[model samples]
Target: MSKKNPKTLTVERAPDQTSEQATAEVAVNPAMNAAFVVDTYQSNILGDDVDTDALVATLRASMDKSAAGDLSGLESMLIGQATALQTIFVSLAKRAHHQQYQRHLEAFLGLALKAQAQSRATIQAVIDLKFPRQATFVKQANIAHGPQQVNNGHANGGDTVRALENQTEQIEVLEGATHGGKEMDTRATAEAARGNPAVEALATGHRPKKRGR
Candidate 1:
């Protein structure tokens, strides 16, 4: 009977090569290290006898199919899942009805509700996949132009400009009414002032000229 030593399995480093150089060589190719890790992982899943190249090719094909937007298989799978959930929901509801304890009934009923919700979600997923919601993209233009003013009350091609001018004039009249003349000239300065002497003199400020009845 021969006894095996673990030290015999270890490879002795060359006398000329330093540890730092050996470590640098080992870490030289990151891509090769990643490939090595992937190989080991796939070997664990598919066994050492499986061809990793063929498996990788198949995975690439599946990815290409998805990238090409061929989703018939995915849609079928979702529909099948929805059907399965519906069956589960019915089964749970029946079980809930047959339960003697109130707590058990409630528990089963809650599970049935969850299954029902999952079924609805699956169906909605299919609907969304088939007839996708149309996305409205509002394009904003950063144009160097005049200022924009929005008049929600007025319709297009109406008297919007005219109405605005009228409003401005009315505002000016209202302001003038609210605040009386800045300066009143009742001095009868020139020919025009002398002609309307009575009109220029305010009744409040100047008493009516003594009229000999």
Candidate 2:
């Protein structure tokens, strides 16, 4: 039998086609696109209607029997409940103790700050009341002692004033003497420049030579 010519299937791609086109296509389904959901189940362990008093009595009886070595069937359950209750009470006690400690710490810090502020205010008040009085006393003492100590002398007021006047007159005399000496020197220099024989003789202690006829 003659084999039929193999059929060739040709796919036409655009010039911009790339190797990424060879990747497999992904299928999207509505079910896969749905959001995640969780279902929670809850049930009451003891019963739908619980009688707390009866439960306590039952647990007490079981504990009594277990203590007496009677091995009641509910002894393990009562022990488990008691352990859970003890853990919860211990946690509550720790929280209460921590809260009390925090309150005490905050109270102590507040008292310390208040005491510091009060002490600073008291010190400032004392300084303000005393400093000006001390300064005024010092200034008065200086003024009271100034006149008696002026000349280091025990003389009376009249003698002290006369002594100060004499010292002032001596200072003025020395200043005048210095000025007179400077004026005399300047006059001598001028006379020398004018060729005065008397000034030259006075300066050298010798007579000038007579000019030739």
Candidate 3:
């Protein structure tokens, strides 16, 4: 017989495909296991036509046994919590954007108040760098004390009036600044231009010849 051609030979073979997958079992605590009824596989929640009293009694008895010795059985309190948690409504926590939430807080006011309170520590940072000693602050008034009451009790007129007038002038100058200060003198350029060389010479009448330097 002639040798069979390898390409012409036919054979039946099973089709290639992956097998069906199964989920692996995860071990959970016994307390959680109490949520499932062993025989019916129904969830033991509040709406069920029920066994709460039995579950509670079972929990109490189990906890009493486990708490002292068994250590693996469901505790009464934890069972109640886990069961109760099934019906609980959990609200999502809202996250405030970092800087926006504190936009209206008085942090700057707090800082300024702290600065005022700790005025002694408000010495210049430059001063701190150079001297090892802590600063002892001395306050100087921008406003001098009003005239002392003598036995005569009169403010000296000349000094007081001069100060008042000076203050009024300063206030007026400040007010003027808001409207824009007075324009600069443009007179010098005009004066120089108008007094041409001929006019200047005429005004001098004639120039004397200079003597030897």
Estimate candidate 3's alpha-carbon lDDT, on a 0 to 1 scale: 0.42
Q: Could you report the Cα RMSD, in angstroms, for every candidate shown?
A: 12.2, 34.3, 31.5
Clash number for candidate 1: 0
Q: Where is model 1 poorest over a 10-residue stretch in terms of lDDT?
A: 3-12
lDDT of 2 at 126: 45
Candidate 1: the clashing residue pairs are none
Q: Give TM per candidate.
A: 0.45, 0.21, 0.17
Whole-model Cα lDDT of every candidate shown, in order: 0.69, 0.45, 0.42
Give model 3's TM-score versus the native structure. 0.17
**lDDT tens readout by residue for model 3, 86-137:** 2231210111222244643344434444444343333333234345487797
Candidate 3 at 113: error in angstroms? 29
Report the lDDT tens digits of candidate 2 across residue range 3-81: 4332211223456765345221111222111211100111145332333333334555656776786753444444455
Candidate order, lDDT descending: 1, 2, 3
> What TM-score does model 1 achieve against the real structure?
0.45
Q: Quote the lDDT for 89 in model 3.
A: 16
